[model samples]
Target: MMKLASLGLFVFDASTFPFSDLNRRRDWRYGAAPRIGDRDATQYLGPGDELVTLTGALVPEAGARYGSIKTLATMADQGEAYPFVDGSGVVWGSFIILSMDERRRALLVDGTPRMIDFTVELRRVA
Candidate 1:
């Protein structure tokens, strides 16, 4: 499993982003970022909005792949984008959620990729 260092998230109406393997040394490949339409752009996540969250451990290979997929899937999802890395090799994972009204946080340990469920939400910590 991998560790979580810091996370930065951006919410946009829409964005076009390229994809590349986080662990592999390669240039950006053609990809897209999820976007918010003009109408939805006005709806801001405020300090009162509830934030839903999920957490788990992930192997390095699968962790990077999950991260890449979340980055690559923005075109269709068009909601929020979050990317984080631990930089330390410890592989301990941590997660936090900033909602319209509150913040939630959790810690995780290294584990296999079988637990990952892409259909629900993509949680990746490198």
Candidate 2:
């Protein structure tokens, strides 16, 4: 099995689930002071905020499991930080789940989703 990345206990792989898109954002904080008849002076404060967004689809017919989404929701409810790690053995940092959105499509006879598209947003806490 090929592994892509992992957020705490949730793993991303072909047999389980995989994220198609991974976006990371990093921002720096700065403060500007107005000067009389001159250019404003800007002072660099420090690192502002960092965020990561993962988007993917889960298809049960293709070996994806639906319970993974529920596990993520449970983790989010705990309001704790989890370590984010990539398959390449890179530790991104500790992050907390900011939000999770899921859209069910192609429903089955029992109203279960055949295909589920999901987005998970995380904010770096440390």
Candidate 3:
């Protein structure tokens, strides 16, 4: 269970385990695919620039609890380094928030925030 600095990005979904997808994929695949299983070349061994991509979701209604989602969702203006820590308090990496999903929106009766869910894509800083 890694935590991002975004606040409540995890833990909002009582039915889902937020940090379940804390994993990285390091590979470079460049080829021309004429068919689904056909590749002209399959040689991809890159250091990935010593960076790992971390993907997680802010709980639905994250904005309501954490304030306006715009605070973090405004990616073009909020390109900053955020700390990424694992459940054991290990500094895994500094992640850069790539983009913000509008956090799925909905029209409700109680007038809760429209944004219910948002996903974050980040690259680990080396």
Using lDDT as the measure, which candidate wins? 2
Q: Residue-wise lDDT of candidate 2 within 15-93, one digit each (tens)?
A: 5667899999999999999999999999999998999999999998889898888888999999999999999979999
lDDT of 3: 0.47
| Candidate 3 off by > 4 Å | 1-23, 28-46, 49-68, 74-76, 109-111
lDDT of each: 0.30, 0.91, 0.47
Q: How many residue pairs clash in each candidate?
A: 15, 0, 3
Pairs in steric clash, model 3: 60-116, 61-116, 103-117
Candidate 1: residue 35 lDDT (0-100): 65
Cα error of candidate 2 at position 93, Å: 0.7
- Model 1 scores what on Cα lDDT? 0.30
lDDT of each residue in 17-97, candidate 1, tens digit only: 111112211122333445666332234333322222323322333333334335435422544444533336333232233
RMSD of each: 17.3, 1.1, 7.3
Residues 43-124, candidate 3: write the lDDT tens digits: 5555453344334444544323434345556533666676656555566566676655544446578865454554555676
